[model samples]
Target: MPRFTDAFRVAEESGQTMAEYGVVLALVTLAVLAALTMLGANVSSALTGVANLLP
Candidate 1:
């Protein structure tokens, strides 16, 4: 009984940790996407400017 309880606790902890990691990964991905979105227009303009400067 004690061994079973320990196993269950370990499984629960592992699941919780996995969930936390997933959330963090999702948040980081969203932040990166947001940063790219905000900078997209500026990046486009910079590229256009560079292209214009080329012969």
Candidate 2:
């Protein structure tokens, strides 16, 4: 009984920690996506400028 309770607590903690990590990863992914979206047009324009200058 005591061992089972201990195991349950550890499992619950692990699950909670994993959930927290997943949330952090999701937030970071969203931030990166937003940054790329905001910069995409500028980057495209810059590339076009460079291409026009090349040939």
Q: Which stretches of candidate 1 lie over 4 Å from their true place?
A: 1-12
lDDT by residue (1-55, candidate 1, tens digit) is 3676666555447778899999999999999999999999999999999999999
Task: Write down the RMSD of all candidates, one decimal each.
Answer: 3.9, 4.1
Compared with the true structure, the alpha-carbon lDDT of candidate 2 equals: 0.89
**How well does each candidate superpose onto the true structure, as a TM-score?**
0.60, 0.62
Q: What's the CA RMSD of model 1 in angstroms?
A: 3.9
The global C-alpha lDDT for each of the candidates, from Candidate 1 onward, is 0.90, 0.89
Superposition error at 26 for model 1 (Å): 1.0
Candidate 2 lands at a TM-score of 0.62
Steric collisions counted per model: 0, 0
Candidate 1 at residue 49, lDDT?
A: 100
